[model samples]
Target: MASSSTPSVRDHASGRLKRAASTLAEDTQSLVSEIKKAFTMVKNIAVDLEREKESTKVKELETLAVQLSESCDNCIRHASAIHTVGNEYQPTSELTDFKKLLDEQFMKLKAMPSQNDRLIRQFQEAVWNVHHKGQPMPGEEEEDIVMTSTQSNLLNVKCPLSGKMITDLAEPVRSMDCKHIYEKEAVIAYLPRNGNKKQCCIAGCPKFLQAHRLVCDPFLLTEIDELRSMNQQTEQAQNVEDFTGLDDED
Candidate 1:
């Protein structure tokens, strides 16, 4: 029932996530190379012609390059998150918001392939103005990217399960089996419902015991507290400076 016994769970998950990430990286590189070859073809043929056809082909290739680049980036982030959670962090399914977080992340990772395929089909059709059906590309539709540790934006950093600040920084705890930390209150709330047999929300290692025990992450908790205190002080200082500036203007 202790978090210390979950290394095997993390190790197995790490291997699988790494393999999947590797495959994705290889596939992306191959696709990018093909697109580059198309560029070479366009350049070679354009040298002998005084026609707009060459320009059109070049522009198409450029647009496809941008799209593929974005897709590749998203794939990498998702894979990286998977590896972090699977290997470095554990997940607890018992928390109220844990599954929701995973579902959101999964949707994004799933979208990458769709976007890639759509772009490929677009390239096959014309590569420039893709006239296709079904759902549009992620950016095209204006869907917001789900924030996670993988993103650098400050707004994205939060408890993965609760989608909120780790308010209980002093008493923060983690289900070691999954390696995910949660506010103590949030975790305790889950314990009453299922007792000590809750399953983890992580993709792999769905054992109930992983969610049954909780560990106080003092080091992590202290770090979170320091960040919170720093932000609070910064905000207070900014407010005072603004007040002083207003007085001077008056």
Candidate 2:
């Protein structure tokens, strides 16, 4: 009789674990979906780099991003189809622990794109190398020349929000989330009027957001100043252009 009861006890524990795993797998979808989008951004950057002229490093990152994306997609199918679970419902402490592990993986996935952005923003030598591939990295004097060239190109560039070419960023504001800089007054006025739902105006911005708030971005202002000083001074600015694709705002 004791031996017969031992089998029942073992089966009970085994069934509970299976149910928990199933629930955790279902919850993992939301996490994995966001991970998919981030990898897509990496792929877009890779394409842009290719158009500009590819760097070996950018290609390597692109390949890695694809591998990670496919792996995440496979997990959804594999985890949900576990054949070990019983037909009945079971919620146990085991399921709770399994869900926590999924949550940790979710955080890790979120950080991956941020890591890529940091590489682009801070270490643009990788991007410079892409354009200058075939030639040695620019020396100090060469870098100065490159800087002058870059600044000159931007002088004619107009603010995306206001078509008027910006000579100086008297009050520069960058999207806190997206990092797309716009003239302070233009964005500040646009935000509250749109129910405080501001978005990055740049084309194909990865981090466009329903901006809840705005803050001064001095770094952008400084860069604008350098560009402004390169040419004749002008205090006049053009009127804010009609915001395209924002019909819902009215």
Candidate 3:
């Protein structure tokens, strides 16, 4: 005959098995949630980077357009002066040649509109490289988690932007207006030039370029390069001091 406790022992074992199964299911669900959250975060970062890349390109093109317009104006002014001189000195060969050169320059200025599409395409390509492909997203750090399973799990992670190994993922520091992620120092360095001297670098924001603030992320070096180019143009314009300096004796 079987012992009286045999059925009770079986029941206890079955209950423990059901509880264990339930715990495992909960754990798996939690892990899935975490993975989903992580992927969403990464996607958001990519989008933000893309937007900033384009914005910077647009600003650069706009600045170039301004410079080109100024050049055209200067050419027009010179041409008028040549025409006046030609009228004063009726047979002046020099004034006639100058007028022809100015006409050619004017034609070139008119041709700039045709180049706009090409310039925009080039700018878009550049923005893509800066946003993706080469570097990791700014501010994110690689992390290694020791997930204990029935066996051991190991993961080798690298930062997307810097290619550095990091133990913890860094929190994103975003530009308040533009929501651009960058290292705090880099953001600060970029903020001063955005017109407000006191605002964030965001297009159309009332406080845009008004206040300077720092956030944390890898600085978009490509954006910095564009900014440097603009600065060089500005410096050159300033160094010229007077538009008539070319006609003046040094």
Top candidate on lDDT is: 2
lDDT of 3 by residue, 1-250 (tens): 3677766765665455444433443344344344334433433444465676656545555455444434433333333333323222223213346456546644644553332232233333344455464333344332211111011111212232333322233432444345433434344455546445554333344444323222221122212323344456457756776755765855
Considering TM-score, which of the candidate structures 2 and 3 is the better prediction for this target?
2
Which residues of candidate 1, in runs, are more than 4 Å off?
1-164, 168-170, 177-179, 191-209
- lDDT of each structure? 0.47, 0.49, 0.39
**How much is 77 displaced in model 1, in angstroms?**
28
Scored against the true structure, residue 126 in model 3 reaches a CA lDDT of: 45
Please write out the lDDT profile of model 1 over residues 1-250, one tens digit for every residue: 5577576676676567545644554454455445445643543343323144456655555565556545544544454344333333343433335345445655654553333432343333232223332344445542321221112212223554565676445466666455566666665666546455765443464544333356442223323543565467458768999999999999
Question: How far is 197's C-alpha from truth in model 3 (Å)?
Answer: 74
Indicate whether candidate 1 or candidate 3 has the larger lDDT.
1
Better of 2 and 3 by lDDT: 2
Q: Give the Cα RMSD of candidate 2.
A: 19.3
Global Cα lDDT for candidate 3:
0.39
TM-score of each: 0.29, 0.30, 0.21
TM-score of 2: 0.30
- Candidate 2 positional error at 159, Å: 2.0
